[model samples]
Target: MSAITLEIDGNKVQVTDGMTVLEAADNAGIFIPTLCHHDKLEPFGGCRLCIVEVEERGWTKMVVSCVYLAAEGLVVRTRSDKVDRIRKTILELLLAHAPDAEVLKELAQEYGADKDRFEKDPSFCIHCGLCVRYCAEVKQKFAVGFVDRGIRKEISFIPEIAARECNACKECFPLCPTSYLQAAFVLTESLAFPAQQKKSE
Candidate 1:
């Protein structure tokens, strides 16, 4: 494979061709924070947390590092004031939508986000699509897909059925980026804790 040289955070590094900016940063020991991006799956620029400023041919633009292909002579800034603001805003929006999600909470904390300025709707999905992608790509089941559009978009197993031909694989649960598929588990645990405490009393 051919090699591509790029400047990441002002440090020169050479990586294999066809590598994404995120992969190159990882190879160079630069940590670019991301959500909705997993090493085991193909890159999907849903979260926008990995946004970086890249300079190419005298022009610079913010691009999601996970999906942007790294090229020779590319100058990348993994973290900047603009990138930080974008990440914080994205996290804030995600937290507002899924406030009960521990994963989202942790990510928000990392960005020092304390409050959401926007109205939160608990019923909507963040639309990361990790569940559907995992089922289709990783599990090879193709059991689920996105239905509807915009805020109405959601993952469904099939037509008119709440469950898909999932093969009982349980792969989607862990891979879900927004914890939508595991909300039941968290709720059940929270409910059980109170009852268990009463039982001990």
Candidate 2:
């Protein structure tokens, strides 16, 4: 594959084919905030913090840098009024869900996002899909997944398999930014596997 040249934050960057905008920006030493992205794991664009503005086909549009593939002659802006507004909005919303997450709080502070802008929710999961993707991609367990959609969307342990896999696999715990999975691991009875079920027995 041919190397592609693109502009990120007014700096020219060269990346190989099949590289995402996030990777390209990283190659250029540009920093794009992200929550759900892991270098070892696949690109999961759950958090919109890495969004960038690009001009494509004469139309300016916002796109997620983590999954948006880099192309030749693409002009990308990692920071701008529009990009900051959208990223701050996303951080604020995430704060509502994970208020106790120190990582989230710090990011909100950096972005000047108002954590109190939205009503607080009991949920602590940011729905970054890190745990889910980690289980499937790295752990190869496929023991957890997402359920429902919209605001109701949640991470659900695959009951039948979760009862067999989750308790032994603690790898995803450290990968979570919020450390919210610790609470879920201890509290979610419905997702309990044999090890947890033994506590009741």
Off by over 4 Å in 2: 189-201
Score candidate 1 by TM-score against the native.
Answer: 0.82
Give the residue spans of candidate 1 off by over 4 A.
159-167, 183-201
Superposition error at 10 for model 2 (Å): 1.8
lDDT of 1 by residue, 110-167 (tens): 7777546678777546777787778678877765678898877766654222233332
Q: Clash pairs of candidate 1?
A: none
Q: Against the correct fold, how does model 2 do in TM-score?
A: 0.89
Tell me the lDDT of candidate 2: 0.85
Clashing pairs in 2: 163-193
